[model samples]
Target chain A: MGSETESARRLLTGWGRTAPSAAEVIRPATTEALVSALSRRPARGVIARGLGRSYGDVAQNGGGTVLDMTGLDAIHAFDPDQGTITVAAGCSLAALLDRVVAAGWFLPVTPGTRFVTVGGAIACDVHGKNHHRDGSFGEHVTALTLLTASGDMLDLTPEGTPDEFWATVGGLGLTGIVISATIQLLRVDSSAIRVDTERTADLAETFAKLRASDDTYRYSVAWLDCAAAGRLGRGIAIQGDHATRDEVDSVPPVPGLKPRISSPRWLSLAPILRSPAISILNEVHFRRARTAAGQIEAIEPFFYPLDAVGDWNRMYGRGGFLQYQFVVPLDREDVVHTALELLHRERIRSTLAVLKRFGPGSRAPLSFPMLGWTLALDIALPAPRAARVLAAIDEHVAESGGRVYLAKDSRLRQELVDVMNPRLPEWNTVRRRLDPDGVFQQDLARRLGLTGASP
Target chain B: MNDAFGLPSRIVVLGGGSEIGQAIVAAIVAEKPADVVLAGRTPVTLPDVPAARSLERIEFDATATESHGAFFDSLFAAGDVDLVVLAFGVVGEQAVAEQDPAAAVEIAMTNYVGAVSSLTHVSTRLAAQGHGTIVVLSSVAGQKARRSNSVYGSSKAGLDAFTEGLQLASLGTGVGVIHVRPGFVKTKMTANLKAAPFATTAEAVATAVVAELGKGNRTVWVPAILRPVMWLIRAMPPRVLRSL
Candidate 1:
């Protein structure tokens, strides 16, 4: 570790907006180095940033050291007999998924985006289409090596240090920096996914179909047409599970099948993304998808479609986009429809509107899932009249038994967060117990008043 | 701006009828606090604070301590309160207060004991929940006992200390306590007083408080230069300072 200013200058967090002008970004390639670094700066807060996927400030800590975990990505040990893989926290989910699939294993849970790091997934307690079945990523973490605020290295799991473990699971990197994690992986037949697609006429039909069919599939999601009104919640529901090698051959080949092709690096540039030429390309791309029921699709097409587009977030332009994700309890399904109706009534266009069924919630106080339905919409920012429209949605969600996901929220009131997640106090208590001095702090944490500043 | 964090972050001035309080509330409400709650002893007849979504009223009486808890409980029970401006107090004539001990006691209780008890209850709940900020109005006149308005000054002194303690106790707790101390504000409370140095209006104090709050400061003295002046006043020998 260098001087405080030096350490502070090197921190590059996920999503360019939150990267600290870190004086020094410590990349501990090994556990010993990580431990040494922690011992050296016992009083400073450390945030572990992986792959930098969080849209806002979940992983960056200004004026403090950032432990870039990506360098510690190597898998330490794989116990095939126990189906547990102990790896460094810096490992990317995409890399983990690829390696695990090759070994007939898969992550018990994965969020929509696979580029996230294992530490990030656990820190945010990320969830996915399979949340209705498997729950959040934290649910599958068997154990984690947490370097506490006091520089004590503790191995935590659901059974060991249960409270601290659960709190750190969704603690948003406030508890301490995660050095490594041992995750329990699920066994799968093959890397391919056997998917079935169906288009629903409206919201009611979609809900009924999901309620009836979700239990049969391991992963389920709906591409909602938020612009549709009256019928309100209409969209295409796609459900799937891991495909056996035999089932993989039955599906029609995707038009462009280059399994070995690497993502083009040039696509990550901002100028190419913001040009009007890309919008036409996007329009053509949307038009190419043929609407059909019971259509079989490949796993890559269904799950990681966006992964193919390098730096897709750049499409939203320099202002970036805000991902508004909230879940309405089943009891408040009517409120969900009312909210969708209002969005449709306003004709606020969101490029990506995903609806999914959540089975039950995890013990994490601010966890985003519950026994009901969740809708996530990615709206391009700087759109005309977008603020007013989002406010209307926030009011509707508050009235219902729902709250937005903090991991994805760039904008939302601190007060509304209090209402939506009443469990925050309990979680904060745990955070204080671990970080009594309030060493850990981030932009999102500050914005949401998670950590009190030193006077 | 309210949506920046995800809820309506509006501010409401309970005593829009108050000149100094309303000016402070108006300035804060301008920064946008999601919504404004403009409750008063009676409906305030004034222009609405700009940018505040709506100004609603609930009949509030500073002297009505018993009703304070229920009134505030019901008000904040909706759970939308992010920042509350406790600007309800009375500054009666010193001669009248001296002649009528009961009136003086009422002023003392309303400004110090009554307000503290009610706000304590409110702050307790807000602290347990770990959110919301309480903005309490205090005066530099309370920094020490003054001959002109010792009764009023003493009441403010108690409030000022209580708020400072609240701020200290609330550390590590999500709830925040902001003590706003302004000097010589040209409001009804000080309208009868002779002109003094560094005299400011309610609007000016309010602007300073709102700006300082955004900077995450715990306590603020309006007309900032007065902060050093206050220190100087504190350092002066008692006999010499009294003569001034």
Candidate 2:
């Protein structure tokens, strides 16, 4: 049965497809329907779900009402001259990317998945490959239209309603149900990227390369080869900037040349899910010479390579997988070294890890990254000493003034959360003030006691 | 074409409308952005296939073998084709085949002679281009002719033999030919048949073919165990096999 229904109970999970919870799901096709659903929330409370791409419990509400935002996917207004688009929160970034990329404008910031909703990007303040230059997704948002717990509709902005705006940004969707928003898009001459790649010997060299030359490139990421026996963090450091129209002049006019309208469908990783298979893949990947100068590539391949495989989580077997991403300040790169060493010592098998360097954070108090190195590792679920390994990493992340991304995290606790983000009390105060009746709540909020529910 | 990434940069599918052809194309494109060309008689659409950086369609009729040479010449004139998937054929009803020998010849020609003509031109282009993979779709039915449908089985038998010969010739020439022998694939052609032993989905075969492509192997048997099973089937007494 379809999960977008108001009357029927539907079980829902995030992109990780783990820890599913049943909820009363209602698709709000119009603002009236959304407001009506919010006004009459059930005992378990209500949360808004958009594309269900949050990776954790953020989009689910057990025994509660979940507003499936996809029904509201529509372009309310578009101005090519101004390079801005006003769209419903439920509209997927994938659907909107087609129109923007064709027009030679792009989203200022996008996470790994383009299938997520614009509202989810704002709620999580999601960062992307260009975070070092552009910052988080919320920074590009011009305005947000929200439905509060008291049945009130409020318009907020970074400059106009700075408090409410920052709170709602990375506020974990606790402030209210996001109805719609105005977003500013970046201008580009073409959809191609001019990429430069170099393989690093170890963690030290990789960190040095990223720290020294990251500012030169609009996008930069390091694919950490965790499977390499002695060279733990050895991998490739890729940097790229959107290719200018002139840069692609060498590419002869191919008849079918056009910007990719959507990301590639998911490819299953089941065939190569075993550790041996992954190790071989990683070894093959790591031996691609030393460096490649520059090549013109499309945006999707540069930004979202894994999007090609559908249901990639299936590769982890039926037990599912967890993506543990944490960010520490620029000075504490050693904490990252310690964490990887710990994983190696534990004999925990993880494929190539993804590492990104963040520039500066935004006004959002609960924003995950803050001028540091963010490392993300995917581990098989039911792994050996899974809890102990993650807990150890979490302790180091917190102790080193680092914090885990709430959207990407599924195992953080309450007190450690406060330690990670000292501004949690302030965010909680703002959340309580905006949703005093606690009508806006979901599984994530309940799990971490963010909305006063005991964990 | 992708010397650095190992993901094929340009792929050409001979029978875009065939379920097996689309599956192989989908698998290759999933690895990375590869310019894909779909050539078929009908307009083919690959649903759920990831967004292609560039996807082109050409009207192609396999029965029109005269155009095979010029088609390959132009397709490979400007760029190298990394992989060519051959999955075009017709399996006519056995009753119609028995009633009219002309209808039976039409099916046989379309499945065997037409495929050979097209593949010959492809092999020449790939050989000159220096490197590429050619995937030919054969079936288990070709392993042992059945009483119910000997015409289709014989046609597949010819295809299997021809592709294997081509594979042997292309060795060390940088041209790879992958002969895929699957048992009872649940495609439109096999929809009417009852659930056969070891029946497989088009996607299951697609996955297996894509995995084998990585190993740079010449032949792949779907369900894998079919390799040993086909061995036993080939060794089975003709009387006992006919009775089954």
Clashing pairs in 2: A264-B50, A265-B50, A266-A309, A266-A310, A267-A309, A267-A310
Across A271-315, the per-residue lDDT of candidate 2 in tens digits comes to 345577778888888896468867888766777666655556666
Residue-level error in angstroms, candidate 1, position A241: 1.6
Kindly give the stretch of ten consecutive residues in candidate 1 chain A with the minimal lDDT sum: A15-24
Name the regions of candidate 1 deviating beyond 4 angstroms.
A1-24, A32-45, A228-232, A250-297, A452-455, B1-244
Residue A336 of model 1, lDDT score:
68
Q: Please, what are the lDDT tens digits per residue for candidate 1 over residues A1-455?
A: 22222232442324523212232357776666776666666333566677778876666554455677777787888877678898888888777765666567778987766778899898899998899999998999989998886878889989867888999887888888887899999997765676777777788888888888999999988877655434456677788887776766653332132223454544334433332443344345434545554444654567677766656666655445667788888877786676666655665556667888898899877677888888887665444445556666777788786888887766665557777888888988888998887766664675566664310
Predicted complexes: DockQ each? 0.04, 0.01
True contacts kept of each: 0.05, 0.00
TM-score, B chain alone, candidates in order: 0.88, 0.94
Q: How many residue pairs clash in each candidate?
A: 31, 6
- Each model's lDDT: 0.69, 0.77
